[model samples]
Target: MALDTGMKCIKYLLFIFNLLFVISGCVLIIVGAVIEANYRTYLDFISSSYLSAPSILIAVGVLIFVVGFFGCCGAVKENHCMVVTFVVLLFMIFIVQLGVGIASYILSNDVERFLHENMLKSMRNYDRSRPGVIKTWDVIQHDHACCGTNNYEDWTSTPYGEEYNGVPDACCKEHVSGCGRNIFNFSQKLNDINKEGCFDKLKGDVEENVTILGGIAIGIGFVQLIGIAFACCLAKSLKRQYETV
Candidate 1:
């Protein structure tokens, strides 16, 4: 049951590819976790369906790592059953990953609207004491040194407008102890207002992160195509062993 030179070459190639696949899977898991953990500021604007994508990638990454092990073992042992199963799993995972990437790209176009709406809505809920989304707006506004969704005046539409009767303290000028106290008199404090908005910055950050994730998906997808081709070739070569016998 000797394998021909070509079959041996393909088999070895498949093993090497699977080893790389394992590493790739581990990377995806790490990347996904980071996205899920640190994306709170941006993801808070996205719906649950879009937000769950990172978690799904984490799960798929773990699965790919496990499945890749089967592939390496099958290629080494020249086991037909294992090789076939590995090929099937790789193909399925490849489709899923590509789909995720495409979907992410599509969503990016409309994400600006969601971000604008969410930020405006969140302005009304800005409070340090309350939990969940209460702190999200404050953190983004304070850390990013911006106000409202578009500018200082965006807050005027929210109930927060009446509650604070002016801009939040987070929108104050530097070194001004009671900068926001003049919130009522925008004309008097024309030089003190923070004219920049949070929407553009937040939108930029979200686009950047989503672009990275989509790139990961596309990159892995290409590798899966190579792996699938190698597996199929090696599977065919396995039949050569029987022929020789």
Candidate 2:
């Protein structure tokens, strides 16, 4: 009777853990979606492949939801096969996530250089189209309170820069009415032009966020230990109970 009671306690405890796992997965999906949406402009500016991170988060979240369901069933039914499968799958995912988190942490540290390089290349292509590229730059500059990838000097080398002879109106301070004139020589508007670049600001923010995310992933990966131990114990207890009967 004591053993049966202990087994029941383990089963319910595993159920609660798996339930929380499912909830965590859902939270990850929402977080990924929010990040992707917030950075869509940057994604559009850079390689589309940059989107894989958020997409993977959503995919992993769904996978966790499914796995948690299996574990929940196994705990509820005290089925040895279900519990074993759950333990194996959960451990595999935990290992995979640990590796992914570590790699992300290391790679995120140096990603800013790559962002700067790619952003410079993307800037040259900015004026290739009229409204398309123009709007992206305008929106990026306006929203970020930044001028160029590096600074206003970035525009000076471009063909469009030669024709326009000045920075975009988006670079002007909020209070400035019209920054249409030759901003470089215009001493009055010089004070209004935002010399700060978007890449530095954006990259710094992203790096901080990535570090936080990597830490979170590593922390969550360790949580699988609880599921694995509980599932294994519950399976063994169930097996023993069946044999003794």
| RMSD after CA superposition, every candidate | 3.2, 3.3
Instruction: Name every residue pair that clashes in candidate 1.
Output: none
Model 2, 33-76: lDDT tens digits are: 98778855555565557668788878888888888888988887
Relative to the true structure, candidate 1 has a C-alpha RMSD (angstroms) of 3.2
Best by TM-score: 2
The TM-score of candidate 2 is: 0.82
At residue 179, candidate 1 shows an lDDT of: 61
**Residue 68 in model 1: shift from native, Å?**
1.1
lDDT of 1 by residue, 1-245 (tens): 55778888888999998998788789989999999898744554434466787998799789989889989998999987889899999988888889989988988887788778766766666555434444566566788888778888876666666666667666766635556554655677746767689898899888877888888888878878998998988877776565666
Identify the candidate with maximal lDDT.
2
Candidates' C-alpha lDDT: 0.77, 0.79
lDDT of 1 at 211: 82
Q: Which stretches of candidate 2 lie over 4 Å from their true place?
A: 1-3, 27-42, 127-140, 159-163, 175-181, 184-188
